[model samples]
Target: MRTTLLFAFLLAALSGFAQDNFTITGDGDGFQEGDKIFLSYRSVKGFIEDSVTVHNKSFRFSGSVSGPVRASLYRNQNPKYANVIFDAATVYLEKGNITLHSSDTLRHSANAGTPLNTDYDELRAALRPYFDKLTTLRDPYELSDQEQKDKALVARLKSIYHNQVDLMVPVQFSFVDKHPSSYVSLVTLSELIRDSRWIDKVEGSFSKLSPELKSSVLGESIKQKIQLGKRISVGTLAKDFAQPDVNGKTIRLSDYRGKYVLLDFWASWCGPCRAENPNVLSAYNKYKSKGFTVLSVSIDEKKDKEKWLKAIKEDGMIWTQLSDLKGNDNLPYKIYGITTIPANLLISPDGVVIAKDLKREALHSTLANIFK
Candidate 1:
C-alpha cells in the first residue's frame, strides 16, 4: 500500500476522539541559529502544521489535537539545502507537557513527559539502526551486467532487506505486549496490519487495550480490520458470488472449485495492477495446464467499460474476467475489504484461500511449490 494513503486513512480513522490542547518544547544540537523546525500531526481535519524558530537550540509548538496523534519534527529548511526528518513520534496531547530532545540530527532524538511518547522513543531507538541499514541497502542504481550475473548475491541482498523488516515485527509485538493499555500499542498494531497474515495476532493484542483506547479512532479501525480479516484470511472458504463477465455470461467463484483460482481485484485505471499484468500472465501461462486459472474482478465504473475492455485486450489477459462496473462500490472489492489495487487471493481446489496479494516472483515461487 502507498504510505501516504495509509496515513490518510489512519487520519480519517482517528477522527472520533476528545480534543485536548498540547504544548511541545524541544532543544536540539547541530542546528544553526534561526533554523525553522516543523511539527505536524494527522487529524480528521487534515494535516495540522505548525512551526517554531530555533533560538539557543530550543523551540516549541502548541496546538490542539483530537487524540493521540503520530507527529513528526523536521528541519523546515529546503530539501535542496538539507533535510533532517525525525522519526514519527506518537504524541499524547491528553497527557501534559511533551518534551522533545534531539542532538546532531533528528535521527538521534528523544521524548519524555508522557508514557506513550516514552515507549515510542524506545522503539525508535531500537529500530533506527536496522532501518538505516535498510535505507543503505535500498539505494537505487541500475544493475550492471556483472552484478546481474551473480543472482545468488543479488538474492541475498533482497533477503537481507526483507529480513530487516521481519525482524521489526517481533520488536513491535513486544512493545504491544509490554504496553497493552497504551494507545501506542494501537498505533503499532495499525502499522502492522499491512501484512494481513499478522491480523489474527494483532487483533489478539488489540483485545488487550484499555476500553477507552479500544473505543478511540485507532481502536475502532482495528476492530473493522479484524472483521475484514475473518472474511478473507487464508484457510477460510472463498465466498461464492456470481457476476456477469464482459460477454454478459454469469460466472461464479464456485465454478472454479476443482482448480486453483486467482481471484484478482483490480481496475483499468489502476497503474500497479496494470504493471503486474505481465507477471500474472506469466504465472497463468506456466500453471494453466496444471489446473490453475485466473478470475479477474474489476472495480471499474459503467462509463469506463470501454477502457476496461481495451486494457484487458491490450494486456492479453486471456482468462475469466468479470466486473459489476460499480467502481469502489463493486461487491467483490467491498466484500474482500480491498483498499488497494494489485490485490489477489490464491485459492485451493477446494475453494479455500491459500495465499493473498502474491505478486511478481512470489507468485511464481508459490506456483512452483504448489505444482512441484
Candidate 2:
C-alpha cells in the first residue's frame, strides 16, 4: 500500500477553539543576519504562511492557534532552488514557547519545549531505527536491472519491507493509545491509516480514541474515511462516474462494462505512481487482448495538464487516461474514498470490485491467473 500525507485534510477538520498563543524561537549555525525563514501552518481561516528575518543569528515567531496544528519552518522559498536547499523542520504549534535548534540546516533541526513537539520528537526517536531498516529494504534500485526482473528476489524484498511496516504499526498505535488526549496522537493515527492494509484494526483503534479526540475535526474525517472505505471493499460493485479523457471526450466506468477493468488512480507529480506505471503498462499489454483494459484517473491539478499529458506520453501508457483536473477534489477519487496514489480497483466483467491495490508481482500474477 502507498502512504499519503493528509496534513491538509487533518488541518481542515480542526474545529474552532479559544485562541491560544505560541512563540517559536530558533537558531542555526548556518543562519546569517537578515536571512529569511518561512513558517507555514493551517489556521481556522485556511492556510497561513508567514516569514521572519533572522537577527543576530536567531529568529522568533509569535502566533495564535485555536489548537495544536502541525507547522513547518523553511530556510528557502524560491521555487527553483527550493528542492535543492530543502532545509525544513516540522513542529506542532500549540500553546506555549517552542524552541528549535540546528547545527547547520533546518532539515536536521530539533524541536522541543512544547508538550506536543516533545512527544513528536520522542515518537520519531523511537521509530527511527524501524524507518531506517525499511529504507534499506525498500530501495528498488539496490538490485541490478537483471536482478530486478527476478520475481523471487522482488517478492522477498517486498515481504521484508512489509514485515518492517508491520513491526512499526504497533509502535504508532501504542503512541495513540498512550497519548489519547494529545493532538500528536491523532496525527500519528492518521499516518497509520494512510499505509495500513488492516481496515478493521484501524477502525478499532479509532474507536479507542478519547471522546474529545474522537469528536475533533480530524477524528470525524477519519470516521468518514473508514465508512467510505467499507463501501469499496472487495465484493462491492465499483461505483460509476464520468470524467473527460485527454481528447476531451466523456468516459464513464459503466462504458467499460462486460470486460475486466482496472480503475487506476494516480498523478504525474507522484514518484511512486510513476514508478508503478511500468508494471501497470506491462499488465495492460499482457491482458488487453484477453478482455482487460486499464482506465487511469489522474489527480493532477488543472494547471498541470501539460505535465499530465507529458507523463502519459513518457510512460508509454497506451491505455485510456482520464481526469477532471481537480487535484484532491476529483469527484470519482472522493467517491471511491481513495486517499493515496497508485491505488486501483480490479473490476470483474459484472462490475464487481474483485480486488484492489494489486501491485508489482501481485499485479502480474493476478492478471496471469485471470487470463490463463
Candidate 3:
C-alpha cells in the first residue's frame, strides 16, 4: 500500500508540472554556444523577463507561467538582429512547447505554438505580401533619374502609400473586431490609434473588448485617449490654450475666439506640413478679409526656433504663428491629443470646431463654402 501511494503522488506531481510549465526552442544558423537569448512578456503587473544560453546554433527556454503570454526574443551584440527577432519572433507561451526557426541573419523568423502565437503568425502571413509590395513600390533604384526628379512621381508615390495605408486599416481592424477577447486586439488597436484617420475605429473597437482586457493597463490608456478624442472632435468647443508666438509674445486660442479660426498644428521638421503650407497660405489670402484667419501653432522646440522661423519665411506663411517651443509636449498638442500633424481644426466664431483635417483642395473648398 505504501509503494502504491508513493507512485500515485509522483504521478500527480508530474501532471501539475506539465500543466504549469512551458518550453521554447529556437534554431538559427549563426548563434554560438554561451550566447544569451533574452525573453520578455507583457503582463498585467508589467513585463516579466527570462533568458537562456545558446548552444550549437540553438537555444531553449523553459519556465512556468501563470497564463498564456505573448513574449518577444532578443540577443546581445546585434541591435539590428535583435529588432528583427523582436518584430517577427514573438511567441505566445503557454503550458506547451513553442518553436522558432530563423535564418543566419535573424531577418526572418517563424513561430509555432499557442493560439495567440498562431493568430499573430496568421496576421503576419496575411500582411507580409502587402508589405513586400510596398517595399518594391518604394525602391528608388527602380526609378530613372528623371523619374526620381519628377514632382508628379513624388505625388504619385504619396498617393500609393496613402492607398496602401487605407488597405491596412481594415485588415488590422478586422482582426481586432473578430478577436475582441484576445490581447492581440489591444496591440492592433494601439497601432491603429497612431494615425488620426483610424482614431475613430479605435474608439469603436474599445466598446467590444472583453472585461478583463478592458481593465488592462493598455486598455485603460486607450480609454484615456478616447476621452481626449472626444474633447477634440468636431462640434466640441475647441479648448483654449496659450503659447508664445515667434516673437516671444503670448497668444491664446481664446484671443481668436471672435473670428473664424484655422487652428493649425504643425512642426518645422514635418515634410507633409511644409508641403501643405501653400494651400494654407492660399486659403488665408482668400478668406482672411472675410473673417477667417489662420492661427498656426507650431509643435517645434526652442532649439529649433531658427528653423521654425526660417520655414515660416521660406514658406511665405505670413500669419499668427505660436509655439511654446515645447515640441510634442506643448499645451496645444497635449490638450488636443494631436499625434500626427499637418492637422487642423476649423473653429467658428463661437469657438466650436466646425471642421478638421481640411487638406489641399478641401481647405479651399470648405473656406469657399463658408465665406460665400
Best by TM-score: 2
What number of clashing residue pairs does each candidate have, in the order they appear? 0, 0, 0
Predicted candidate 3 versus true structure: per-residue lDDT over 92-130, tens digit per residue: 777778777777623366777766766777777777877
lDDT of 1 at 194: 59
Candidate lDDT (C-alpha), each: 0.79, 0.84, 0.78
Off by over 4 Å in 1: 1-19, 32-35, 44-46, 55-57, 77-92, 139-159, 242-258, 266-282, 298-327, 339-342, 357-362
RMSD of candidate 2 to true structure, Å: 8.7
Clashing pairs in 1: none
lDDT of 1 by residue, 124-152 (tens): 77788778877777521235768745645
Ranking 1 against 2 by TM-score, winner: 2
> Counting only residues 3 or more apart in sequence or on different chains, how many pairs clash (N, Cα, C under 3 Å) in candidate 1?
0
Residue 334's lDDT within candidate 1 is 83
* Candidate 2: stretches off by over 4 Å: 1-17, 28-35, 53-58, 77-81, 102-104, 134-167, 195-198, 240-244, 247-259, 268-271, 289-291, 299-307, 323-331, 368-372
Candidate 2 residue lDDT tens string, 1-372: 122347655555554357889999998898888888989888887989889899877899999988789988887573334654467788899889999888876766778999999898888777888977876776563678898778567667765766676798888877877777788888877766664265567788788888988898898988877786666888988889999999999999999999999999999999879878877887888788989999999999999999999999999899999999999999999999888777888999999998888877778888888888
What pairs collide in candidate 2? none
Reference-based TM-score of each model: 0.74, 0.76, 0.67
